[model samples]
Target: MNVQMADAEITVHTAASIDRIAPEIHGHFAEHLGRCIYGGIWHADSADGDGFREDTVSLLEDLELPVLRWPGGCFADDYHWEDGVGPQDERPRRRNLFWAQGPEELPEESNSFGSDEFLELCERIGTEPYLAANVGSGSPQEAANWVEYCNYDGDTELADRRRENGREDPYGVKYWGLGNENWGCGGQMSPEQYAREYRRYATYVGTQANLMFDHDLELIACGFEGHEWNRRFLEEINEAPWGAEFPLDHLTLHHYYGRGTNVAEADEDKYDRMLAEALEMERHIERMAGAINAVATTRDIGVIIDEWGTWHPEATADNGLEQEGTVFDALSAAAVLNIFNDNSDVVTMTNIAQTVNVLQCLVETDEDDAWARPTYRVFDLYAPHKGNEAVRTSVDTPTRDVVDGDSNDELPLVNASASVGDDGTYVTVTNLDCRSAQTVDVSLEGTDLNEDDIRGEILFAEQEPDYAVTKHNADEFTADDLAVPADGSSIEVELPPSTVAAISVE
Candidate 1:
């Protein structure tokens, strides 16, 4: 179907303003599942010397991730921050009941990675820390103590404990999560029940700011997508005895593309399905924004896609939730990022599921060596769009109807979004078809803009068929893949099947 494509035109109205794209929208999630915490991001007395793997930090730094959500997808609720602090040997090793994907007790959580470790990791990679508190299995006092320990500079017991841990200055964590999925694994509570829990936690976990020291903390409540999660959460939250001015700053939602929510089981039509699902992200943003606006007491409350990206395959036996990245995955990522750019107004921050070795991970490591997957490459290409003003792009292209199993979906073979900044204009295009190469004509508008005045790079398979577009395993990867080459002009570009191209005017 892609092979039959001829030409397409993308007109970017640079004069039109589409809001500033927050770098946080390209954020990552690091869960305690699998190697994400253990082998992938942390190790003792190694390369970085502070326990984190050297190559892991180096690769993550390359992603330019603006925010990193720490600790637990489902594991956050069961987490007791107290168990992770103080001495490493003294930290308790608790049974992780979430990674087994059920009520069955399985796997052990080494509380080696705590608040200090998480904050330190964020500092090394220059990403803001978004800590999710334990609201399910832990008490309000425990959550409150963590806030004080991380943000308070006062001579309190918690602050003193933090000082004794060898870090004198506060971590000053601003983005705080009240809880994770309360409707599901977090608690399996009714929406009303979770809202009640949120109030209790937010009451104690106030901004953690004091007169002597001030920190502007943005609190996010665990929200849901699909179902009535958002409506029920927002509706009941206001009913919350709040005990103070509503502390909720944002609502959280999670999405994964596929029927079973596992990527390894994705069929041949996975790419087409992902493209269709990615397109639906725009509608999801709009609907969520509408719901948020309707019930929000504050004008600043927005939606954060805190946990997203594809989670394919059953977890590996020893590793659990580990996934390999693919070229199709890259295109899917491009489509999703473009949607985030389009809805830059309200969809402020998004973290791609688990950042390492887990679902949709950017980097997979074997012992000391780390490999940057195709998904990682996608983020690198989009780094320019961060904090840039979104430029409206109209793409006129042919459509293809993909019959994915029992579902029928229609989507454009070509998708694009553009942004303008002090540096220049950035236009990223994604082609869903994998059989044919496509040529697209792009124009940059606005008084200060000129698209053709810059250079471009393409990731077409035809140009480098031997290059590894994705890696199924560590041994199967090829490192010398084609960099987005600077051979072409900005106005004209070629896209091969399942390709993502970046055009820059710098």
Candidate 2:
């Protein structure tokens, strides 16, 4: 097949080879700051007695979420674990000064949703807990206490205190984050300073057995861009005078897509640029992971993109810290997931920027009404990729420039990835073009399958730049809007431009 381009003709290859695909990636992450905890996931007005919103829980259950991160973005740095524990009445509350504009308030520290509550929520949702500890403005002892509070089972002081507080059994959380965004919201520390603090915290926090029975507790040292922080962290751990091989299981990296007044006002060109930023996250993960692996070979440390998603300038408009998720956001999310699948070897775990109302949240709420955002739909579409091994697939297409007017830059037009599971093979293809649709032949080389055996489901909207959050049709969309593939396998189908199509082959 020949695709005519503005400047030249490009040949398309139908039978792309499957040889160099990466492993499948893991998903998890949520912060207590913003509505993520209060209005988002933990609604005090829940019809269910658990204080968790039934609608939210039901939506999460539908996605089959694998893991969840909690309690902090920048808020983790200033979070006092004691503030959120014990009795709600006895707990003191303080005004959140991190994201909030006004002065710090008091009597705001209710333990209604502290360690126990969070773990319970995770259990209800059927996902693993990824806890972030305080490093900035917090002492090493504080960090140690939290670990002990969650994992320790012996009759020690902390354990006894936990028992006195409420439950006697340990939560047994496996993943622990040292800090969040140390370069910015996490206290603006230098690479050397953060590395030293990471070593100090890792040395003190005791390890916990993995409750899920997969692997041991992983202590993730917070890492930054470039090789500076990675090198410093490895050096500190390797050359420690104590000679302790603290199990640094993962290093964290964060990236956000879209930087504009609002996602709605973001031009198609700018949206394309945001797609490039999402793609760049994979490169960042690759470079950072390589640096960490090179310095420490004995310990198996993977990369965790704990915080990532599209961040619009207008995100804080509705409630000062809330961001709207649109159809464009959904498309971008699909692109990001593809990148993660492509680099799953080193990029093991990722948490979308938030679970609820921060940025690119899966679901959004406003007092009485709750709706699944476009990004959430993308997650629903790609949920099957979770825990599945990734399969390699290649494409030959005419590449066109994705131009952004604001930045005056261009990115590639075609983006695609594939994953194979126990049931069948799944391929996700995206046409970055905003207007035109391109037809290409796809060949499955390794598997002996007929084209008629494949099934395809395409997610697209008639309107321009439709997103999950905004594309609400009161009559059409419902909780069931995000189910498995309804349409059986067909040989030819139109992949709507600027949309995601999930193709399943049995």
For lDDT, the strongest prediction is 1
lDDT tens digits by residue: candidate 2, 1-506 = 12222221111122432233322144656665556776667764232336777777887877777888877777788888888777666666565547542112121333456777788888887888888898988988998888888778887888888898777888778778889888778888877787778878876764334332234667877777665777776776677666456457788877886775466676666666677777787679778877877778777777788878888876662353576666677777787888887677777688887787677788777556667776776777787676666665555545555555664444556566776667777777666666666553444554544645566666663535644444345323222211231222123334556767776777
Give per-candidate clash totals. 7, 20
Runs of candidate 1 with Cα error greater than 4 angstroms are: 1-6, 44-49, 100-106, 210-212, 240-245, 259-268, 314-319, 404-406, 447-452, 460-490
TM-score of 1: 0.89
TM-score of each: 0.89, 0.86
Which pairs of residues have clashing backbones in candidate 1?
3-436, 263-311, 263-312, 264-312, 264-313, 315-321, 434-497
Q: Estimate every model's Cα lDDT from 0 to 1.
A: 0.75, 0.66
- Judging by TM-score against the true structure, name the best candidate: 1
Q: How far out, in Å, is residue 148 in model 1?
A: 0.5
lDDT of 1 by residue, 1-506 (tens): 12323388788888887999999999999887777777788873122327878889998987768999988788899888888888887777787777742112247776777788889989989999999998888888988888888988878988899999988998888898988988888888888898888888887776455443576778888887764778877788767553554568888888877434344445546656666876777777787888887877565787899988765545454546765566666668888999899888887799997787777788887665778877787788788899999978999987778776898888888889999999877888887775576777776664333434565665535422213333334333322232332223226566767778877776
